[model samples]
Target chain A: MSAFKKIIPLFDRVLIQRVKAAERTASGIYIPEKAQETLNEGLVVAVGPGAFVDGKLQPVALKNGERVLLPPYGGSAVKVGSEEYLLFRDSEILAKLE
Target chain B: MSAFKKIIPLFDRVLIQRVKAAERTASGIYIPEKAQETLNEGLVVAVGPGAFVDGKLQPVALKNGERVLLPPYGGSAVKVGSEEYLLFRDSEILAKLE
Candidate 1:
């Protein structure tokens, strides 16, 4: 988490760290790592200032530490040390989890 | 041209009519219709008011009658009588052709 502080997304771009899939099934059976489905859930790490609108800056709607839904595709993938992160335009975020 | 007056693009969308490909080469050799390449040029027929930014409506950058370069794909297809037109967001226009 501390390593992410160095990355400040620019222009409405949001940096997100994907949440790992569950390792167990609802029936309490252990699921193999290869069988786990990729989750679309993510935690927002940082957001850009905003995209320009008619030459004016409009602030991004997302905030740090917010849990959000991510699209299945798009977004630039980044690897920090051994952990991975993704960068996407604020508009690409599907929705806020809560 | 008169038929186009009835259709107006909305929300920064621009209606464009594609220009036909050339039937002859510079050397005056006749080119078969099947051999001609699809042109990416288009004439803007109408432009939407603008997309909302921070709740404010921003005017579109393009104007009617402007010739522009278009992307190889995207844009909605529309048929009016015997003519075909395409609708694209203002941002999708590649560049203005003087």
Candidate 2:
């Protein structure tokens, strides 16, 4: 957590950690690496100040600890030690998961 | 131009046409396709209504015909007939070229 805190996204950017895929099914069937379905779900870790609009700075809508849906592709990948994270603009996020 | 008008970007999304790379140098040296360097510049074609913030919609900063810098990656590619365009959030645009 301390490592991720060191990162401060700029201008409507949001930092997120991708949720890992399930290694096994409910019946205890192990899924192979290639067979695992990659989910586009993520947890918001940090958010940047909103971008300037009409010469004024706006506030971002997303907040820390929120679960979000990610697009199939895009976003900048960031590495913190062995942990990986993603940086995307608040607008790039598809939706918020309830 | 009429064809591009059909596209209406949603939420802070921008429609852009990538600037073509130069095939020849000022010295008239022909550069092969493999040697051609792809540029990250684009011409703004269309823009979406600003995303909602604080229960109100803000307006996008970029306007049509503006030259902009694009990120090395990201953006959704759209094909209209033989022409290709890219859709990206206004915030994804790096800088506006003067």
Candidate 3:
């Protein structure tokens, strides 16, 4: 949390940590690393103040800890220590997961 | 203009046509296709009504016909007949060229 706090996304940008895919099957069968599917899901770690429009600052709809569906590609990747994070504009995010 | 008018971007999205790079050198040398550099500049064709925030509709800062700097990547490509266009969120646009 402290590491994430250091990142302040600017102008409708969001910081997200990708949610890892499951390593095993329901029956407990191990899935090899090569066979793992890369997921486009992530958790919102930080959100920027909304972009300004017509001289007013609009607030972004996203909140911290929300699960989100990411686009196939496009976010800027940032490495903090050994963890990787992504920065995307609120509009670039495909959808908010329930 | 009529062809471009057919595209109406939604929700803070913008439609842009990339500016083409020069095909000849200052000395009147014809630059081959392979040597041509793709430009990251574009003309704004259309803009969405802006995304809704806190129950109010905000307007994007960009205007049609404005020359803008585009990100190197990230935009949905659309083909209108033989002409190519790109759709990107307003925030995805890097800057406005004077």
Candidate 4:
């Protein structure tokens, strides 16, 4: 987590870390690595200041630590040490997960 | 053009009619339809009120009758009688051509 502290996304960009695939089922059965389903869920690690609109700064709608639904494609990938993070524009995020 | 008057795009959407491919060159040589290059230029037909930002309506940056650069893909296609038009969010338009 310390490595990720250095990154600060710019201008309505959100940095998200994808949730890892479940390794075991709810019933406690182990799942093979090859069969793990890729999840579209992510945790917001950092957020940028809102973009300027009509000369006014509009703040980003998301906050740090919020879970969000991610689009299947389009984001800048970054590797912090061994962990991967993605940066996306606020509009690119599909929804906020409750 | 009367067919298009019925359309009023909503929320920062811009209606654009693509510029037609040239059938003849400037040097007076006739170009076959198959050889004509598809141009990404378009004329703005209409524009929606800008999308709301920070609880305020931010009006679209484009105006009707302006020439604009279109993205290679991603716009809602609409056919008005025999004429085809595209509807795109203001942000999707690449640029405004002077």
Candidate 5:
């Protein structure tokens, strides 16, 4: 992979790599792709300075390389470096993975 | 309009009415619809209880009748009655309008 990628998400948006969904459920049932939610786990590659607050910039709470669980409905799909990444605002992140 | 709508967002999801965009700028220049960001103002019609936490439910911070500002991305398109509503999780809301 190249050392640098030009795509930097602007304004509180975080760039993430979507984790693949498991093919089968714990009960050993094969679930169809459409039945499952697209919301997935990911590694934060880059994050913008937190959303504007009272005309001031707040520091982003999430750091690069942290795993995150995103909400299903946010973010736009973009292809980068042979992988797919979703760009969404910091507020769009549903939870952080331990 | 019917007194009760069959749609209710589940598990921290919310239902909102989308605000219309202004076609012309204050400068009197004609702006294309696609040129502007989709994030717009809205009113909270219904909101979920809250997202899961250690297998327990948390109370949603937003109320049913408050005005909100949703992030540019997030929420799915759905039509109910004579208006349009976006269905998305609480995290998808970028800000609460004053």
Candidate 6:
């Protein structure tokens, strides 16, 4: 691992790391290894200042250290600290872990 | 290449397939096979009816036959027709392809 690509998500954005999808759930069930898809779990590393609402700044509902579900189809992947991370807007987050 | 899971996103949900990342784009630039990262680029397969707003359903601004950029972390991956696809809400979509 060399220099990590500096990532700075703008307004209301989020940085998530994809959780690896290991082997199947037994019974020979296989989870396909697709390029465009990622796992369901992720750790929130960085978050944007907040989202704009009705022309005003609205604080984000998601916070750091929160395990969240990211939208598989809307973020950008970047290498960071020898690992890969995804950048997305606040709306891309589907659910937050309670 | 068999039976695809019947996917009907309830409201504002979307189904996307992960594009496979092959051989580090040559040049030995290994994209790392750590098991979590996926490639960009996917076909919009299915979308949810619509997302629930405040207390009611709002119309979706996205349309079918559109290629979209998916969030890297929020959606759910499922098997559909021998292929893997991800499911996420409409909000997960960031920029639409013009």
Q: What does chain B score (TM) in every candidate?
A: 0.90, 0.91, 0.91, 0.91, 0.72, 0.67
What's the DockQ for every one of the candidates?
A: 0.03, 0.04, 0.02, 0.02, 0.03, 0.06
After TM-score superposition, what is the CA distance of residue A88 in candidate 6 from its true location, in Å?
Answer: 0.8
TM-scores for the candidates = 0.50, 0.51, 0.51, 0.51, 0.42, 0.43
Q: Write the per-residue lDDT of candidate 3 for residues B77-96, one digit (tens) a residue.
A: 99887899999998787545
Question: How much DockQ does model 6 earn?
Answer: 0.06
Better of 1 and 6 by DockQ: 6
What is the C-alpha lDDT profile of model 1 across B1-98, one tens digit per residue?
Answer: 45545788999899999988778987999999999877767889989989888778877767888776566689999988888999999766654555
Give the per-residue lDDT of model 3 (tens digit) for A46-74: 88777776657779779999999999988
Model 3 bad stretches (over 4 Å): A1-50, A53-98, B1-5
Write one digit per residue (lDDT tens) for candidate 2, span A1-98: 11223565657788899999999998999999899999999999888777876657878879999999999998877654578788888899999999
For candidate 3, give the docking quality class from DockQ: incorrect
- Look at candidate 6 and tell me the lDDT of residue A33: 69
lDDT of 6 at B24: 70
Q: Which candidate number has the best lDDT?
A: 2
DockQ of 2: 0.04
Residue pairs in clash, model 2: none
| Proportion of true inter-chain contacts also present in candidate 2 | 0.03
Please give the distance, in angstroms, between residue A10's alpha carbon in candidate 3 and its true position after superposition: 11
State each model's CA lDDT, in order: 0.80, 0.82, 0.81, 0.80, 0.70, 0.64
What value does the lDDT take at residue B86 in candidate 6? 71
Q: Candidate order by lDDT, highest to lowest?
A: 2, 3, 1, 4, 5, 6
Per-residue CA lDDT of candidate 2, range B1-98, in tens? 34544898999999999988778876999999888877767889999998987678877768999876677789999998889999999878754555
For residues A1-98, could you state the per-residue lDDT of candidate 6 as single tens digits? 46655566688788887767655544866766663344566778888887666666755556788776555477888876668888877666755443
Q: After superposition, how far is residue B9 of candidate 2 from its true place, in Å?
A: 0.8
lDDT of model number 1: 0.80
| Fnat for every candidate | 0.03, 0.03, 0.00, 0.00, 0.00, 0.06
Residues B11-94 of candidate 4: C-alpha lDDT, one tens digit per residue: 577789999989999998999999999999999987876667666988988999999999999876655447877878899999
Q: What's the true lDDT of residue A5 in model 5? A: 53
> Could you give the interface RMSD of each candidate, to one decimal?
14.4, 10.6, 10.9, 13.0, 13.7, 8.3
